[model samples]
Target: MVKVEIVEEKDQQSSANSPYASTSSSRHSSQESISSISSELSAEETLYDRINALVDIVPPATRHRISTKVSKAVSFVKTGGKIMGNIVWIVTTSALLVGLPLALSLEDEAKIVAQEREMMAQQQGAQQMLSPGSAYPPPPGSNQTPQKGIVPPGF
Candidate 1:
């Protein structure tokens, strides 16, 4: 319970004879009034206080049910977050494990194709050299017939 009092304003000349007459006394009274106003403002219900008051109005059984539902909702959100995090981790790990090896294998296959092309080019150049109108003629005493069944060294 609280009680409030209202005082009527008095003329300055009349107040000049009162205890609040001196400059220091007037300042002190002003400070007191400001502090009292601040205290009254502070005494007003805050948002949290109002919410608590509303909650107190509900029946105990209803309050319990509401709290339980809220707790479950919070738990569900936390669990869903953890599950999403795990899914992301799994996807990233799979990409590293499977995709990395696949990329490396593709690179190796490309190298093999390049090597095969180089081998074919070399074979073509050797055949050109052995042709009749070749840049270099055969030695004077050697047989010019093509050799039939000899495989190249690195084949």
Candidate 2:
């Protein structure tokens, strides 16, 4: 029949346009993808349900004990934090109140002592320069003779 030949010709054209195209295979692949997506969604829901179900299975006494232990641990951590904070505050305050001034005073004392030593050295040099003796006196602890060409042992 002419209609049958037309349908056969249209099918041949479709196959020529795309050699690998097939309606059955496309439907099967789409079905597989849809089923896989649904399975994943169901798996997630099942996991959520399982987790929510755990709340009903624990006994009240066990839950109470767990809660009490958690509360005690929290309180202990809070107390320790407060104590450590107080200790740090005390140390910093003491350093500012006591240690800073002590360090400054010690540094000032050292500077004063150094200045006095320099002044004393200058005074001794001036006294030596003003003296009328032709030769300066030997230092108290000296053992070396003051001969003109004498060299110290190390030098």
Candidate 3:
């Protein structure tokens, strides 16, 4: 049962739009009321101003309750931070897991390709060694010497 009288003070009702004033009883002695009050005031208020006012006048016990609630909420939110840390480790390990095998397999494919190229080159070299005698056709009556057996390198 809080009773309020708008005194002739300048800044008295300045914070009237505050939460305490808005949420509490508006027992403001109106201009045409039983007890004729002097100044005429409008009732326009915003939520922040009201909340600030309530915080200012809150009793110690109620304030403690509010503080405890806020702390609990903060700790709950930070509980997810632990999971986030683990998630980073999981993601990095998974990426390495996927990438390592792929890189190793690609290296194997490259080795196969190189081995195939070496085999082809060796086959071409062997063919060249086996087939001799070039493009100079005997002019008129030129006699050519016969070539010998074609043995590969390590034989």
Candidate 4:
């Protein structure tokens, strides 16, 4: 509830001139002023005043129940958000802790296997170049025949 007071100053010249005005005339003027002021105040009612009047129509118990329910709903949403954040953090952390090491180990094993294969191929090529009865034809003036079933490097 709000209380408003409106004060207006009377004209001294008018009062002095109407020092002997009839009592009926004074009463009429006072009633007219009161009515005009009331009308003006009603027309200028604030949004807060209208809403407060509307809320007053509802029962107190119902308002209390609605407020409590709304508060509970807000708290539940907050809790769920926190839980979701924690789950995401745990998942990402676990992936970095476990998956990362396994991937690195697999990559290193692949590199080692590739290096071993390369070393074997080099050894085979050296042996072929040094062997007398290789896949290639013999040197000039030399009496040697090509091998029967040896495949060249390209094949």
Candidate 5:
């Protein structure tokens, strides 16, 4: 009975290890690489499998085209210098376009500031010249003249 039990266990282990124990698995290659990659994918799949499938598609045409474009771009950059001459030209032109107006406006601003200072100084001078006795001088015979004919308070 013990010998029979040992034989049964060994059979079950071999059955489990086949990988093609289920019907879904296909192609049993004897090469070491193919044998090593026996476990291709699983039945209960994930998002990673879907994404990997998308990247694994290698059409011969797209690969060649992509590599050619990359090599062409590399060669062009190696021949040409880092900075494009047109960019420097455009930058200088734009600086002059924008800076000229600002430079001209600064001169006008100085003139306007000087005119404002002169007007304020004139106003201050006029205020200084005003009499301390009266902002508006009274007409001739105003109230409370303190004359000889007038009666004094409490008199």
Candidate 6:
């Protein structure tokens, strides 16, 4: 029983030191500090207002020069973009115009090649058929008199 009591006391002490321990005063102080910091920041001038204040310190002539430079830069960017777009359009149109005819010509050439190959094959077959060795020899007793202008079997 005594040991159990001592363990309970130790558990309480350990929990008090742990982060999960909720102390109302500490939470209130943290919330107060956050609110104070937020309020202080809100009281400061906005970024745009600060920039305008800084710009006010510059001489009028210098400000005018800076504005002109900025405007020129913007216009240059716009003009470059337009020029690039036009170039892309021209190149695309040229490719389409040139590629169509080239593709058609290539197709025609391929067809011509195929036809030539077929003709060559047919000529080879005909030559094989006309070759004397391709025919069977005449039967043993079927000899006929040879006539003038007639080609002989071996010829």
TM-score of every prediction relative to native: 0.45, 0.54, 0.37, 0.50, 0.31, 0.49
Candidate that would win on TM-score: 2
Q: Tell me the spans in candidate 5 whose CA falls farther than 4 Å from its real position.
A: 1-83, 133-155
lDDT of 3 by residue, 17-129 (tens): 55454534456533235456424432665566566777768898999998999999999889888889899999989889998899999999999999999999999766654
Candidate with best lDDT: 4
Candidate 6 at residue 120, lDDT? 100
C-alpha lDDT of residue 104 in model 2: 100
For residues 1-155, what per-residue lDDT tens digits would candidate 6 score against the true structure? 35543434547777779776766688796887787764332446786776778987999999999999999999999999999999999999988999888999999999999999999999976775555443443435755333356453577
Off by over 4 Å in 4: 1-54, 131-133, 136-155
> lDDT value for candidate 5?
0.68
> Candidate 5 — worst ten consecutive residues by lDDT sum?
144-153
Off by over 4 Å in 3: 1-77, 133-155
Give the range where candidate 4 is weakest over 10 consecutive residues by summed lDDT.
35-44
lDDT of 5 by residue, 1-155 (tens): 35543434547668768765743434433454476763556667776877767755867688789889999999889666446666787898888999888889999999999999999999975764353333344346665333245343357
Model 1 per-residue lDDT tens digits across residues 51-81: 7778768999998999999999999999999
Model 6 regions lying over 4 Å from their true place? 1-44, 133-155
Q: Say which prediction, candidate 1 or candidate 5, comes out ahead on lDDT.
A: 1
Q: Could you tell me the TM-score of candidate 6?
A: 0.49
lDDT of 5 at 139: 47
Residue 116 of candidate 1: its Cα lDDT? 100
TM-score of 4: 0.50
Ranking by TM-score: 2, 4, 6, 1, 3, 5
lDDT of 2 by residue, 32-92 (tens): 7787765343634777786777878999899899999999999999999999999999999
TM-score quality measure for candidate 2: 0.54
